[model samples]
Target chain A: MKHNSYFDGKVQSLELHTENGVATVGVITPGQYTFGTSTQEKMVITAGSLRVKLPDQDWQTVMSGEFFVVDKNVSFVVEAEQDVAYLCYYF
Target chain B: MKHNSYFDGKVQSLELHTENGVATVGVITPGQYTFGTSTQEKMVITAGSLRVKLPDQDWQTVMSGEFFVVDKNVSFVVEAEQDVAYLCYYF
Candidate 1:
């Protein structure tokens, strides 16, 4: 039931499935990246600060307990200031 | 930008994406369910208790912080005794 998928030295993507939609949780370290092309997606900051670079938009800062929905199919990069852990739920 | 996707009236599917694999988080109420046909999936119980009925397997009980890996491509049912909140991460 419980498995430890470590992202200490690498980048990984989490794909989730259900009857409604999908959700993904990404773990980003400093200088690491996670990309997406969804026009509208929900992101939750579980831990740490994440620097989100959206297409045609300036870099935005997302903190813990805060989330954002990308209204456009924008390519974004997630960078961690320290050690960032996030849960990106795509419906 | 945090949006609350409530499942008080229905069931939802969470689809996650990354370079590694997909992870899904399902929230099941009493008598609700989430199904899958994937062999060898990692599941994490964030909260509540989930009763799992696997193929060719006996009924199993999964509680908070306890997860199991279904090593065979089997259909399973998740039922809650009270109210169960779980995070199923597949990678």
Candidate 2:
């Protein structure tokens, strides 16, 4: 297990092995952020929500229990009004 | 946010704020452990499952998307056969 911190500890993640494959459970503090992905990521909102802007798309709210996918080798944007918890699976 | 490690890091948690109150997201390795709570806890399984024995009750399985509540000032037992991720809300 590994714990990774990003954006000066405002965002942190714990790596774990899941039935679906390698995944991370992370928390993001209230702020706006842009993330780049190496693998295609399936971002599942476990608690709270994320306002996301995918490539060539409009901003959308992804609520708890909902998910959004990000393609590999692209940078995407996310905004959080409050602390958000998510589980991301890389494929 | 604080990251708390327990059981020699076999169980670790990251603290966060949520609409429900103060909460933590954590991961547990494959093992059995007992925990004592100071506050009433709402334990939600985010990934995998927990074999839990609440106080005097028999062991039962708590699957993902399912939750179990533990009373304050009590000790409970939980066993994981694989890596399990969960969110615990304290009230």
Candidate 3:
């Protein structure tokens, strides 16, 4: 797994994988972003804050210990503005 | 996201998603099993104990705060026997 940090060191892609059938975990900081395209994805916010934006202009804010799922082909953006962290897996 | 628990009353699939472009998280427990097929998958153990079994008869044990990824076309199994928990996401 690969962990990458971004956004002037405020965000991170804590884990990245090239595998197709495994589970991985990561941590994100405040003002971080997890970008998605026409593909499907799933995620959960284990701690802190998170913002999810959908193509239909619908968005949501999640705080510590909250969970959400984004369906396929829905381009979206996830961001944290206040010391947030989350865990994700790809299947 | 959906959260489910199973076991000899001891395992759980904390979260499940049908989406392809988002991230989700879940928790697992002791003596729990996460089974995979020939497809690719990724996972991380945020807390507690975890055991992973590969198709080629390879396996590994993970403890609190450890992470790992599984590649495509590789079937595997994950089991915990003593009070374990984890967080996962799909992308």
Candidate 4:
């Protein structure tokens, strides 16, 4: 497992390998943040919600048990009014 | 966010505040671990699966999207054959 903390520790993730591929379960504090992806990503909201603006798409609210996709080599924006927990799978 | 590493970093978690209560998203490396809870815990498997033995219960398989509950002050054993990511809510 790999532990990663970003945005001055406002965001943190713990990495794990599953049958789906490499995945991280992380938490984001209440704030806005931008993230760049090295591979195609599928993000699942495990707890709370997020307002996500993916590349070339309008901002959308993703709630708990919902998910969104982010393409590789692109950047996206995420805003949280409350702490959000997510599972991100890289493919 | 609070970053916690246990069992010599074999297990790691990031704490987050949620509407339901305080929660932590964590990953456990392939192994067996016993944990004692201070509060009632609801554990949801997010990435992989595990064989969990809660207090006064038989060992059972908990898969992704499945959840198990443990009473406060009880200890439980979890065995993961592969990396497992989980969301634990303390109430």
What's the TM-score of every candidate structure? Answer: 0.45, 0.98, 0.44, 0.97
Task: Tell me how many clashing residue pairs each candidate has.
Answer: 24, 0, 34, 0
| Candidate number with greatest DockQ | 4
User: Candidate 1's residue-wise lDDT over B1-91, tens digit each?
Assistant: 1111334534433344333355544445456565666546777664456788877788899986688776556677767765444444454
* Per-residue lDDT value at A44 in model 4: 97
What ranges in model 1 sit over 4 Å off?
A1-9, A18-20, A32-34, B1-91
- Model 4, A40-64: lDDT tens digits are 9999999999999998899999999
Candidate 2 structure quality by residue, lDDT tens digits, A14-55? 988999999888899999999999999999998898899999
Rank by lDDT (best first): 2, 4, 1, 3
Candidate 3 vs candidate 4: the lDDT winner is: 4
Model 2: which docking level applies?
medium
Better of 2 and 3 by TM-score: 2
Could you tell me which 10 consecutive residues in candidate 1 chain B have the lowest summed lDDT? Answer: B1-10
Candidate 4 docking class:
high
In the range B8-84, model 4's lDDT, one tens digit per residue, is 99989999999998999999898899999999999999888989998788999999999999999989999999999
Residue B10, candidate 4: C-alpha displacement in angstroms:
0.9
Ten-residue stretch with the least lDDT total in model 2 chain A? A16-25
Comparing 2 and 4 on DockQ, the stronger one: 4
